[model samples]
Target: MAQQALPVLQPHPSCTACDLATWPGLESPGLPTRVWDGGHTEPQPKKALLLVGSHPGVEENVKGSAFVGVTGQFPNRLYIKGGNLADFADVYLTNAVRCSPRTSELVTPKAVAACREWLDQDVRVLAQCYDEVVILATGENAISSVLQRKESLRTFHQGQVADVGGVECSVFATYLAAILLPSNDPSKILAIREHLLLVWRYLKFGYLPTTVKVPPPSELVGSRVLDPSPTTKLISLDVETYGAFERNHRGRLLPRQTVFHPAKSLHWDGVQRCDLVQTCALSWRSPRGGKLRTKVYRLDRRAECDRLVSVLQRLRQCCVLGQNVPFDVLYLRAFNHRFRRVLARPHCVLYELQVLNFLQNDQRAERSLKNLSLVLGVADYRDEAVDLKKGQRYRDSSDPRAWTYNAKDAQATLLDYEFLVEAISLWYGGDTDKWSSYSRQWYNEVLWLTVQMSENGVHYDVEQLGRVHDRHQVALDWLRDRAKRLWDWPMSGKGSGKARERIIADMIQQYQPEDLGLARQYSRRVKKSRLTGKVSAGKENVWLLMGVVPSRTPDRGKLLAYRRFQRLRKVVESYTGPLLHQVSEEKKTPNQQTALVKGVAHPSWHSVPSYASDEERSFGGTSQCRITPRNPGLQTEPPKIEACRRSRFPSGALVLADESQSEIRVATGLFGDEVFIQRETAVLG
Candidate 1:
């Protein structure tokens, strides 16, 4: 007799934070992803577990921990009132991702790149360890930390298990403990407890038990980190000056620091150089008075970038703090991108805390530094009023106002920081272990993340890419011709050199190379699926991009096409870099290959796809093929794109396959035929 499949309505354990699909790990032929084939199910998760949402604060960015933050009070409240902090079977807890994003704007691609692996790691481990993993989605930010669609989640509601490691599970949604009280139904403290209780029952034993309050803080459930000692003391900070010429809600410019000033010595772009950079920072200091003496750093030259990294390296047990850290993080990131090689590992940050408050606080009022101060009320900085505006003259006057302002801001921040730290001691953490523990359990959260995610390592394939450049000319030229043919556009060198450069640049601005390159790698597939599409997805993110360079010989090109991809399957297992995936795609599909190319793992992070196409069959075809899995989780899908028959397939290029469901022949993409599967798999016992 056919039995009815359990009415699954939630994510699987291997689904990561969002129940979205993802590769379990980067063993081989693995790619980052958020969605699973089973889709979202309504099945129950392993029982006796706690679900901790992601926080946008110090713990997350600075310490690199998931929960156990100031904002964690939201989930904490649930436990305090009804749910048990560790009442679950194994207390399976995780965010949608392991790391916080660099930008507050949350570009679709970046989000996927940053968290795909985190999602997969948690789910895969949990799935193997428990039969029912209870998920306590603490609002959208928390939910988004695990789930893919952040804006669409409802507070204090129930979720159906949609998918897992191609399995089923269940999720119970609830208001983030951060949500303000006294407004909504769950607005009342009593109601908040009630919601938590319901979630608790749902998580405890698959079926909802008519409980009324959260189980007692689940018996000191998790640990923050495994290591007994701290990693390093280096933090990156960004400041947003209060007195600025900005008036618009979108952070406008009105001669404010954000606005570009010709007189400003910091040669930078956008608000960073103008307003953000104008902001000051607190540097290495020694305790002098009631408050520690501080050093204010004003980056007047490019050398400051290197100097900052130097400071981070020098400080062994210190942590960096800042307001709205992304500003500072981005600057550092840009430096890394431009100069090549950023060995900097960030520590605590004030900015990460502020952003998390925006997502976790659940308040209607503007969540600013002032509001944060008000909420914490840890100090009396607001009362101390000095004619701060008068201090403006010193900003551009070249006297010493800038340094003063930087010093003052840093000191004031330092005072508040002390309070924030003391306050943090009261919070309990989950997960213990250096490699896996959430840092908050032991030390600062954001600081830990910086170390765990340190540019672990970067590798590139130069020989493989050389071929990519040769065949990419025609496409590059065509893109230019299209631009030149337009109305008042200039005619590039004889053919279309200038046109090519501009158009290609525009395309680089886009993640998809199909639009600018000779090959049509279904970028739409990436966009629609929402993958990170990065190089290191299997490890950090799930999305990967591959290219099919024209082979040395016609037959050789053909054989190298898929065979090359198969070879890469092995190297990708070892390199484990970031992926450039789309938002929706990161939720489910593995790295969508743009093309197939032989891969070699070297410590060089130089990989740029050619912006041109080919005329004489760019890539030949390959007959000798090996099968591999595309994602991280269970043995699923194929490393090879269906039966990828080729004619000029270019590396980092995508082509369609399977008429009814054609996919981009992404190089390093997966096939589940088993060639890449590991013979010795680890089981959770």
Candidate 2:
């Protein structure tokens, strides 16, 4: 059989400007001429540029083709297996520095810079041929030299998107096969191979299969515009707060040093004062497409809030969207009753995006407006000129950057909403589809339910909480004394008593079974390190002392005492003290003897958990009194800590309902399995 003919190498016409023949160490003795797979020997449309570091090995230089050596074979095989690109003929492969370096010294930065002229010309020519050129910079040096990113390769994530020259591309900053060949670890080889496949996927398609694609740059609108429609409208809202000063867990104003403005004539008579001073809203008529005429409102004055309320009231007839709408609504309600009342039914874009992402099982989706804007192809202006970390207040600062940030936030929110709507529509057919409608309605209902629950907070007895706090304190003292006596870990009475406490803690932390002469019975296990290949402790952790204690061990009593002390300490610090402090003295009404417990407001009662006994839960003492047999434990007890106290329902009625066997029912109904359904029903009955 005749051997296949190899394509002849030729120099690019533009290479003459650099005078490659006269360049030091880059002479054409063993150096291969410019080699590329001229696909079809005809002008077929160019798809992508397969950019790499430098020339092939010695054998490849003789053959005048790239990737003919062992170093290049791994990527060639990966490209074929990935199915995105078939063969070498599919892509135009080139390098940053065209010549292979002599000896072992790789191409210097100076050499790379000198050869950049030829590279840039080649890229420009390729960009003209290809409709969209995707450059795959394979290594750290290639990434820095070609992509011009100043950050180290360690900082770059796999399949990270970056813009090179005029085209958008994905970067894979990993060691090439040449570096991997000498390593004994098979995992490193496999990792680089996988990275190669990812690069192929990115070059063939615009993005990795794992990530959701943003809209093309052409589709994104640079300026804020409102496309007016009769039935529907899109309004983006944002609020800038001085600082969150809500009531603490103890029902007292947090950041106690916060001072309110001396404008007593403002309509804040019966309402709680909040940090909300400025609010921005941008309203656009929708079916968000083409040129849009937008209405922008920036309100800070007390009278301006009334106008903002009127605008929001009008927006209620349309779809009002915002990031974390529940939070904005809470603050707006505090600003004025009318603002809250008007925004009662606004659509929360954050919740909508979350629901969509949940349905698609895309856990990487972020709810922040800034992140969403960047992911959805909108330019973010949050980081320019202003340091948001400094917490500059909009009311106090005269700098235009603050206002610009606020306006951009509102604009980004609107753009993100528009993009999500279109993306979802494409994913699940249309707006009226079952999946699409269900997700939107479910999230809306949840948001409203949360608001209602927060407004009507659960009732708590301050007197009972105080009694519980006192009881826990007494129990903690007893446990501490008992543990100290049992374990011979006495507290210090030295100067600055904290020193003695620290000594006791260190002793407890250093405790082991062997220290108590139980090493023979309770042996420590060993674990091997993945990176350093070192062996260390596997099961001798002091925290896991309870698990290691034998059933008939002599030191069981001492271990149990120490555990009890730890539990008591946690309960006093984490629960009892905080709970006691959070019980607000403000009465709900004159007739009703009810006080509110200030838990986290956003999720309202959703985060609360049911209570359990000491043994069932991790908290120390058993519950002597049972509140209810139906709901045995108090909800929202710190997981494993059983120090949960019973609270009386303000309405004197506690009802709980859940979808009974919903998942099984749905599965049976969908599969039309009558036999399985009958069996489940019989078992349930």
Candidate 3:
């Protein structure tokens, strides 16, 4: 079969700018007059979208065509790859400057200005050739020629939608495809593809397509669908497990030992015994619904467990909607590999409520299913007759009440899903298309990314961390002994337990300028107490001891040591201690590992305040490489922490790259801060 010919733009004979010889740069030069590239000349069924480039490159100049050379192929490839755009619409490729300059530098503002008339004429002609013509101005020169704006390309790189030559189009000031392609980063490619996808969708749909199409429940199962198709089927699932497990406020899993149990009046010994799935309750509403069908599968029998796994595998194909789907998915994966693979895309009713709450800007979005059910007026499972927390293992318990609790939970989950679906549908004015798009595209993608991030955890160095912990402990002990000696306190016995606090109290009580031989330089004064509203003798704290003491004072070293001790003590207790406990001893390798879990706001990397470690504050590395396992402040840690940097890449090698001052540059351009731009330009230059 022969290839169909592409449409080309018909040249305007009467237009003076169409003739390259008339332009200033090519007036006394030698260059081709008709530099227009290959495109459809005749009107097409669909609209034509034009991608405008700068002046022709060296290869383009030889070929006498725009976007056919090395530089032009970048956008051409993207255009074809972006949703098969060519099949839907006619695409015209052209340049701002028709005649190529003899020298690279000769393609200047004067030449661009001279060629602007021809570009404008070409756009005017193209606008008439298509029903809806859109122009994508590629670079600075192309944008300037099309938009006729004096501002540089930096101002428009963020992308703008406007009317060009009476045709509505999107201007991409940053689409330097050739430059971006060389990096070979998939993320960069994906970014460009996403932008192009948006552009193509805008051209096809008039308005940008914001919604994602939700696959129908029947379509999801396809040929595997159960007999007798129904408009709606409620599939509710719940799993009961032996042994207690819970997540902390920061979403890190803490052992029962770290958790305070008021009933037991004690904390569990930080050891978490391996837990087993006790029972799984599956409740479903059939097509011919009279009453909900419920079944409780006990893991005691091998046949029953296998049956449960098989059923779950099928349910996964459909939207296995549940409360805290990630938590359920994690346990399911741990139970069976098949369950793990199938439950990867399970929908969470909790996540749906969160999305709706976020959209409404509801600050206090209810997270717990129990709380949410109450607010949403859905059936609350917690009010059931059975004590849900009483049973340890379903095999041991013959009580029918335990099974009823499980069944009730499954039923409640299904009811919650139905209620949320209706609520969200009503919120969107019954436009399922818009609601589906927001849910699948934005909410689903975010949830999926979070799950993947949690699975791809970070590495930890147990040996190195242990060494650092010991050193900190030794230093703290020495600091305490020194403080005790300074205060002339007893070195041994029960009094030593509270020695440090006692020393601090004594120092405060005996605080005098003469004690530090600073009587001549400093004097104490009586001050009104803010809390008691009474005039009292001035008090001295660690800050005053360090800052107010004379430089020549002999006791300055002791005060500084005490301050250092306080800082190190905090680092040991609050940060390192928790982290050390979390490191798994079963791994048997010197380099241990820790994992990150997704939080409501961000991916929890277990970051800690870097200021706690003195070495971290002064180390100065180019990239941020901090890791605070079992602690919630790692992300805030500075890059200077050497231990953190080492821990980031446990294999003893580090590779880090970041966009330097990208936000500052964006702010400079957006606000048109010429002074800041000039200053940055000079400094960067």
In candidate 3, which residue ranges exceed 4 Å CA deviation? Answer: 1-236, 244-275, 283-295, 315-317, 345-361, 381-399, 421-436, 488-559, 582-633, 636-685
Candidate 3: residue 70 Cα off by (Å):
73
Q: Name the 10 consecutive residues with the lowest summed lDDT in model 2.
A: 608-617
Position 632, candidate 1: lDDT: 22
The candidate that wins on TM-score is 2
The runs of at least 3 residues in candidate 2 whose Cα sits more than 4 Å from the true structure, single-residue gaps closed, are 1-231, 244-275, 286-290, 293-296, 345-351, 390-399, 428-435, 490-548, 582-635, 638-651, 656-685
TM-score of each: 0.28, 0.50, 0.44
Query: What local distance difference test score does each model get?
Result: 0.35, 0.45, 0.48
Best model number under lDDT = 3
Q: Write the per-residue lDDT of candidate 3 for residues 252-362, one digit (tens) a residue.
A: 443332221111111123322223344566655675744455567655455666766666554533444455544454545555565655566543222433344333322
Off by over 4 Å in 1: 1-279, 283-291, 301-310, 332-343, 346-351, 355-366, 378-394, 397-401, 427-437, 440-685
Q: Cα miss at 327, model 2 (Å)? A: 0.8
Which 10 consecutive residues of model 3 have the lowest summed lDDT? 608-617
Residues 1-685 of candidate 2: C-alpha lDDT, one tens digit per residue: 2222333434542343323334464433223223333343233433544546554456554555666677666555543344345332235565555655442234445555666555555555555555554555555446655656433333344554555555555455444445445542233443354445655555555554422222322222222423234444556666655442233222443232222221210221222353344445453444645433333333445444565566555544465566666555565666666665666754332243334433432322133454445434564333346544444332231234444565666666666666666765675667545346565565667666655554554444556556766776788677657656655454212341343334333433444455544653343332222222223212223235556555566455655554565565555554555444333112222211111234211112221112211100122222222111111123434433332322355456545434446667778989989898898779779
lDDT, candidate 2, equals 0.45
Give the least accurate 10-residue stretch of model 1, judged by summed lDDT: 607-616
lDDT score of residue 657 within candidate 3 = 49
